[model samples]
Target: MAKELLINGEVITVNANDEIVEAVAIENGKITAVGTTKEILQLQDEETRVTDLAERTLMPGIIESHIHTTMYGANVLAVSCKDPEIRTLAALLQKLKQHASTIPAGQWVRAWGFNETSIEEGRFPTREELDLVTDQHPVMVIRACGHLSAVNSEGLAIGGITRNTQNPEGGEIGRRADGEPDGRLIETAHMELYQLAAHTRDEMREAHRVASAHFAEKGITSIHDATGYGLQNIEALREDAMSGVIAQRVYAMVGALNKPEEVVRHYMQLDICTGEGDEHFKYGPVKMFLDGSSSGPTVWTTAPYTSDSGNYGIHYLAQEELDALFIPAHEKGWQVTAHAQGDAAIDQLLNTIEKALQLHPREDARHRIEHAGLVREDQLQRMKALGVIPTPNPTFFSEYGDGYVTNYGDRAQRMYPLASYYRNGIPATITADCPVADFNPMRGIHSAMTRKAPSGQVIGEDEQIRLLQAIRGYTLHAANASFSEKETGSIEVGKFADLVILDRSILSAEVDEILGIKTDRTIIGGETVYLRSKEPVNV
Candidate 1:
């Protein structure tokens, strides 16, 4: 057995009892003991490595529930367009222009993280504006929501898009007053644009490495890679993880969104479904997308947005189409999940899942609704009764809360109802959505309590949860989402030693101070994968 002991920490166990212990003992990368320093000291032998915590805080390594490993990696290496970075349309265009100037004439100039709400002009950049950046090279600037994008003339031509090019089944192409293509691609169209401007294998590998290290530095030990482009990308990611390019435990999702229909069909022939593989990498749910983004005002809403009258937003698939995809996956015993942001989309999801369950029910199969951004009182109750899990992104409160208030008015309070999830007996998991918003687990925890925008406006005061509940959402609850709770979620005697040592005590800190709390060290399986301090961690 390995020898390691940590003591004198505010150890928040996030267990059934929610205990705060003083120390923990580790053996063979699993928790061996937990209690006061003296109790843990008794378990330590002469060869054991015991380290003083010096009154720091220790908790489960933050589990980022839903993140796009490869996508976030590529976005990190792209131009900056996210709010508080490139705020004005002119400034964004200028940044793209500067980036274009450095690249070769025929190369693609890509940018990500655009927020129309946060920018000075409060609008999407036109294709013409992007052309001004550079017409010689194809340019695609994707919105932060990842639901829409605007590409230059060259890009449209490269994709064979024209005024007459019809909108795909689940996507749209922007057009000007005269019916000329305007360069904007929405939903599935953006997916096509991504395909046209796909990153190189070398580029993706390099970016994946950067993203892995970044997640480690942020104290994240586990993540769900929700959107791998196709089987090829999935294979590549698995290889990366197996080779230690990705250190964190990965719950890699399979076909539905980026995966071609044929690829999914072929996969069904395999003996495996979900929950396949080992501790390092595992197959997750059959994931799919059902609607546009709430912040993009393209969410499939039952009520028209307050900001856009007579427009109820977009639903990517019909009930029949969703059933064809989901019912098969559910029947096959794979956990099913979809990106349903608005009430209308969630409604569609509930209907289909209910039908699938009626056909063949698995009591323990926790089908999930990702980004249930907006849900009514009735929907929440239905979710609890049907045993559907709602995985919401609390960090969106910091990035899109003001826009939600502006677009939905009082109805915005229904978005990401964390407190209501608990009251209704649902263990709603929380996510940061990474490239869509801030990825820090601390920011997600803070958003759960405040429900505030960067402007300090609390959009949903009634939905705010307590600090401990928020902590649970990111730790044990997150692990439960992937069926890995028994192995890694808490500080139990047999759980993996996936723990984060923080510079300050989040349990004792004021609500606002939580965001500033940095991770001093991140340990996974008794190994220090990341350490902020340079000093020796000796016995």
Candidate 2:
């Protein structure tokens, strides 16, 4: 194969194999040379492809440790209320009433990212308010936290939920002060009806394309997508990969919530793990959520919530139940990540994981603790001792900081502890719990470094990580968490040529201006997937 040289740039080589170099060379789809311009030019020939760097920074492609890609893509193009004007009960109803003319009556009209804290009047949207929008159409507005949703009476009836209905094992049906079904659905296990909303395969595929384009434009080379909807999503991803439309490499963690274990077993039957297929796509861990979001009333907490004292959210997996299912799954050598937000839930998970590790003792197991949000000082040490990775959604700072404040008060301030993870030697990877938060790495990086919430509050100033650390949280640590570090995380010899060329160097940029750094180009395996300007270069 012919050589390709990238010259004249500040290269941040995140690989130990190569020092920071002024130029790099790629032959086929792997790094051939990484050094000074003169050294890279030594490998050049008439057939070589040379790219002028324009003095911008060249680095390993960005990786999102945790993102729900297809879901986020569909949600991006979904018909719902995200704009502030339509966030409230009255405004949402008005907006739905406006759009209802097109849809047939009695169809489910679902919208996502509705925050109760965003409502100026300051209260959860009631069933009555949703009814005003459309009794004919069952309108369900999911909370921004993904822990709750408010649905109209028609939707409640459709789901077979009623005032007399018991709360599901790991979920709840929010009730009014007068003891009525208040139209709010809480926890993953609680919202079975909403899970049924992703029935349209075509819509999901379209959304996946949009979502992928969004990441490519921002220079994301890889993602650890957690929302495993089903075989349909896997098929969609496969189709995109085969066609070369999906440029970003993906490490998928199949979820087993309402999804059958047989489905997970089916994927396991594929006998795939780290670096399963060609450079672009692979399957990694199996994901399970033990609780819900901290900003919503579903995260099982140690004490009663400071806001709502009577309510301590429930746990999804009972001890005996987990022992039966989770233990066996872990013993079978499946890398697992559990969504345990509240400290108590995390403690339960820690205990469960410890037992499994003792029984299994697979050194390279690399199991993960998803969300792993709230932790006591003692728990931090335990996490480090266990060698568990925390895939934190620091994007929560920018997306739901205010909601967290309202939900947990002082406790919320310490949520998403980046510095704590660093201090305890726990390798942490940051992410956007997308569809709930925007799946933008810049947003995640900004939130981690600044700890500045969308409401402009510095929620956890002490917990704020440095810009460099924040970058690694998305890149190196993210790759490690997914067990893809060997092949993809860093820019090194024999590594796949996954690279991002930025218009500005993020490492040297002013702290506040880092988010402004845009991607001029994105390359995967020596192929330019996204190029902003193709005008002839001066060099």
lDDT tens digits by residue: candidate 2, 214-275: 88888888877776466667667766766666668877777643543445667656656434
lDDT per model, in order?
0.85, 0.75
- Per-prediction TM-score, please? 0.96, 0.91
lDDT of 1 by residue, 1-539 (tens): 57788999899899999999999998888898899999999987778898888778989988888888888898878796863568788889888888888978998898888877778897788888888998779999888888889999899999899998999977889999999989899888888777768777887788789899999988999888876477766776777888888889888777634435545666667898888888888888877777888788788889888987888888767899889988998899888888899899999999988999999978888888988988999999889888888889879979888888889888888689999998877988889887888899889999999999878898888899998898888888889889999998788888999999998888889989998999899988888889998988665
Consecutive 10-residue window with the lowest summed lDDT within model 1: 255-264
Model 2 lDDT-worst window of ten:
256-265
- Pairs clashing within candidate 1: none
Cα RMSD (angstroms) for every candidate in the order listed: 1.7, 2.8
Q: What TM-score does candidate 1 get on C-alpha atoms? A: 0.96
Note the clash tally of each candidate. Answer: 0, 0
